[model samples]
Target chain A: MSVVPDSSTDASGVGADPRTGPAPGPSRAARLATRGIPLLVLLVLLASAPLFAAPFTANTLSRILIFALFAVSLDLLVGITGLPSLGHAAYFGVGAYTAGLVSIHWTSAAPVPVLLAAAVGALAAVATGWLAVRSGGVYFLMLTLAIGELVHQLAQSLSSVTGGSNGLFGIPSVRIGGEPLTLAGYVYWYVLAVAVLGFLGLWLVARSPFGATLRGIRDNEPRMRSLGYSPFRYKYLAFVVAGGFAGLAGGLFAALVRIVNPSDAGFTTSALILLAVVLGGAGTLWGPVLGAAVVVLVRDTFGPQLDGHGPLLLGVVFVVAVYVLPRGFAGLAGLVPGRRRSTGGTA
Target chain B: MAGWFDANLVSILNGFAIGSLLFILAVGLSIVFGMMDVLNLAHGAFFLVGSYLAVSFVAGVSWGGFLAALAVAALFGLLAGGVLSGMTEPLARRPILDQALLTLGISLIVAEVLSIIYGNNVRSVPGPPGLDGSVQVAGSTYPTYRLMLIAVGLLLALVVWLVVERTSIGALVRASVADREMVSAMGIDNRKVKFAVLGIGSMLAAVAGVLGAPVYGARPGLDKTILILALVVVVIGGLGSVRGALIGALVIGQVESLGRALLPELASFILFGTLALVLIIRPRGLFAGKVAHS
Candidate 1:
């Protein structure tokens, strides 16, 4: 009779199930070769990307990387923690606006605005998360939607500060060691570095004991409560952490784009990010990055080609992806016959 | 005080008119969610479809044409709802998120198609000829159409209340909402009930779209705007309760219309602020029904 889906049977194997006990351990060297090699290769390729790519290509890649960070942060909530937030853009926009303002009125140092944005994003989460975390499931989704719309309204009405509908303009390029990185290649390098670092931080957290507790709660909240864990505190902390990273991504986005607008924190952005997480595979950390790339390429890179029917195309993607790829693109790993069992451990 | 009342009377009446319109849009959404755990994100798209139908059918704003438009919109909603029900059927055992995404996708496609046909212009329908004029009320002149809208909304509300509260069909719906398993155990086909509810609910949204065309107009992004408003109303009133939808719509209507007149800068904030405050104080909403089960 329970309407809630069975989380344990989820093919994507996002978070480790408490009931299944710990997964069998891979040998240390074996784990390194399996996980480390591809990551190393990817890093090398991305680092060398700006060397050969055009300026526009570098910029688009930077956007993909920024959104990858954003999508990963949201994955921490929707995929790992099992909280379906529809208003995550609130924190992202807050971070972007904060970074933009910091760059405009204060120093444009790369880390200063980015770090401050993360802090502000976490603070915003604290302000809104306490009330939101009180409810779970669809109610949580509605509350977040309201909070998101509230922030969007604030951005629209606080004309003097947010520049109203026109958004915050005149944002200077990010500076490194007292030199502005004005070129797209240099900006992409900076974005790559920050995104890599942010992704690593989230990756570590997802593998931590805290992350296990979140997965446990997601699977069965009442059981978690019975085991003397306060689901509220854990969810609130996860929300703040996710918000901080989303803000970091937003900060990098503002640095890359050099502007902050209301649409950055609007519902459409939130929906798109959520779609990215779902499309990529909810529980897998890296899957959403792939999803974000597809989303950005489709909406921005190729959307104009079909007479601006990008949304139409995206709509079709959503429908098809839901039915065809339930566990998302990451879940595709589980589809390969013999790889099914192994994908449960690594996917 | 008298001057303030005189100045704001129109806004108050406008609130009632808007509330009625919102009730028509939201009651179906609420009930459908309550009965079937499907939050049809495309509810707004259905409404837009109705509005666009009005734009086409009510060409000269004649009374007969308007009635025909309403009838057509209702039939279209029923057919669309049936399709949506079938589309979402396979995902019934999945997470609400899946259903949400599926409906959102449907809505996007519908909106895109409509925009393609309508050219994204803000096309508005005029009221049927007799109701197109204005009349003096208190110290201000009010649109005759709005008064009619208010009366029609109340009449519809009354009819809906009678059907839900007094009829055997309403008992089945209420029973299903209260306990889906028990209803099925009692030899009822839950899927059939869900289909009927979704169809009726969508029809309400479509009919409201046609009814509200003169006030809100048919526009490209209007679906999203109306969807958000309806979500707010549904949240405030409590999900799945007819009385709650009415009360929530009325409350939101005042908060929106009166808030704008009283504090333009914080008008939108007031609406969401009320939502936040309500969630904080009473997370289940003003008149939470028994149907909300996570």
Candidate 2:
């Protein structure tokens, strides 16, 4: 609650200083900002997709980019906040359904539905977060899971609105500023911009004072309480914020696909996000983006071709990550001679 | 008035029948969770495995072979538990995130392997010959197999209660769960205890699956559904507590069965409603059981 940013309080012991803030000499924030330049450059490359990659490849890239936004939001909770939520798909579904419903009935500009989607996502988070923040440790994990499952069940059952087991189809393309954004190349550019902005925003949040407080709560809740900070408040804020981003991503997805299905809220979506976080290294800003790309690519390459072996391969990869690279893909930095040390195992 | 009482009693019995089976399955889940910290997301896989294996076992043999099938299912649980232990052992050192991910991966693998072996189709195991018939109960002709299922569920629940509450191995397991380091310090290798407990837990799940197949039916996605229900049971029953498991099972089972019978449309929603209400009141679980650590 204090406005003064306490630079010294790494007291919440979850991980090292992920927040690149007002430190001495050139400021770590500036350095991180500079480091982010390459990511932007990559984003630029992604945006000009049809020029470099094939249309199908470009569409794949767009899908990955959209998922990357979702994954990055997940990383806020899973990696940075040290709350490895297994059921974030609740928010994702909320956002998608919001947009889906909006698009189905009333013809509106894309931004309206997107905003509504984010709003629904935030609302869902607030509702669920109120209950979810009570329990810490494993119990917290289970509670979030239940909430996510509950939402999924609701969405599946409310067929009149959600279209039930059979999802809404033939949804018109997103009408943006009185123009239809139907081109895949245009969508890819939009997705890339959104993902880049999402990452940047989260990265900034991770460096902010609120981020430091979350770290404290994650590492040692009792100690945080001793320091006069309520862990529940901090957790609730972070949960809602994370949910908001998930909604943002979900809205973007609904617009692009023009449909929202039950899978949007299922365990598989949760698993996918979890895998991405674990792969990219949960707390790192760029980790989920990288992990999402890898997961999407692997599935795109192998899943359809492998016929019944896709899940087996993915499962094997997941097991290998758990045992071998607990820190995720970004965890490889630890193995390098002079690279940054990790906060914990990749998972 | 008599007819109304009879109708309500029938619904309640039907609910109890379902609840008892859930108790059987969830008891194993509760015990394993209580004794060992492993979530065993793959626990439901063992149940599915039990159902399929029972189908194979029944195809060749007579009623005497049911005992053999049950034993085989138990043995499978033991082997599966061993594999699960091996996979989750490293992450088991740390809490929470590791256990969750490792078990989740194991579950995925089990599901994939099952699909590879059995294909993505619903398959049924025929009830034992004599029990295949229906019996008149409370003016409703319930399947004889369902009645046997209730009997088997209760019988297994009793045996589990006896072994866990009264047996030496149960005591050792409980003690280890209380303090693993202390138990190990006392020269009672907690690993052995964990392995044994996991084995029994898995056996319980398998037996539940076998018995449940004729009553609840079998499908490709049964593992996933069973896993979610078992989790609900664990949360309701309290982590690692046998008594908690029984209550949780009965409550969830009744909700599921009655929901199916009465509210045909909202059957799935009913199970979740009970879970949500319980979770709101008691986040640690309605019954925390005897384990010191969550």
Enumerate the candidates' DockQ scores in order. 0.50, 0.47
Task: Look at candidate 1 and tell me the lDDT of residue B153.
Answer: 91
Top DockQ prediction, candidate number: 1
**Model 1 segments beyond 4 Å from truth?**
A1-14, A335-347, B58-60
lDDT per residue for candidate 2 within B36-147, as digits (tens), equals 6676767777888887777767722467666677788878888888777666667666655777777777777777787777777787766777888778886877777777
lDDT of 1: 0.86
Kindly report, for each predicted structure in the order presented, the TM-score of its chain A compared with the true chain A: 0.91, 0.87
RMSD of each: 4.7, 3.6
Q: What 10-residue stretch in candidate 2 chain B is worst by lDDT?
A: B59-68
| Residue range B63-98, candidate 1, lDDT tens digits | 888989999999999998888888989988777888
Measured with DockQ on alpha carbons, how good is candidate 1? 0.50
Best by TM-score: 1
> Per-residue lDDT for A1-347 in model 1, tens only?
12223343222234445566434556556766877888899999999999999999999999999999999999999888888888999999999999999999999987999999999999999998888888666777777877787788789889999899998999999999999999999999999999999998887777766777787777677898999999989999999999999999999989999989998998778888888988888868888999999999999977899688778888888899889988778778653222111110100
Screening candidate 1 with a backbone cut-off below 3 angstroms (N, C-alpha, C), the clashing residue pairs are none
Error of 1 at A216 (Å): 0.9
